[model samples]
Target: MHTESQLARLHTADLLAQADAHRIAAAAKPPVELRTRVGWTLVELGLRLASAPGPVPATA
Candidate 1:
């Protein structure tokens, strides 16, 4: 008979395998609008930081 710990491990392993499959599927999808939006946002942020005056205060 499977002990509780063994059953738990089996369940966890199954979940992880499913998650890995999902991640691979997501990676295979074509680039969507959100990717462009996020990329442009990063570019804008970089430009703003480049244009900003003065050094940022260092925290202790």
Candidate 2:
């Protein structure tokens, strides 16, 4: 099983990579501001998830 941080890191890396690709694609349109926002958002979420190093309490 993946530890939370490990899983989060994997997920964040994937998103950051996608964002970079999107940024590159935006080059086709000089004025277009296109970096996949979801990628950055996911990265933030992943970071938050990874910060806690221990079992999570179950929500009732």
Highest lDDT model number:
1
The residue ranges of model 1 lying beyond 4 angstroms of the native Cα positions read: 34-60
Worst 10 residues of 2 by lDDT: 29-38
The numbered model that scores best in TM-score is 1
**Tens-digit lDDT track for model 2 on 1-60?**
999999999999999999999988887765623466677888999999889698879999
Task: Give the C-alpha miss distance for residue 1 in model 1, angstroms.
Answer: 0.8
TM-score versus the correct structure, for each prediction: 0.53, 0.45
Question: Total backbone clashes of model 2?
Answer: 0
Worst 10 residues of 1 by lDDT: 29-38
User: How does model 2 fare in lDDT?
Assistant: 0.86
lDDT of 1 by residue, 1-60 (tens): 999999999999999999999999999998789889999999999999899897879999
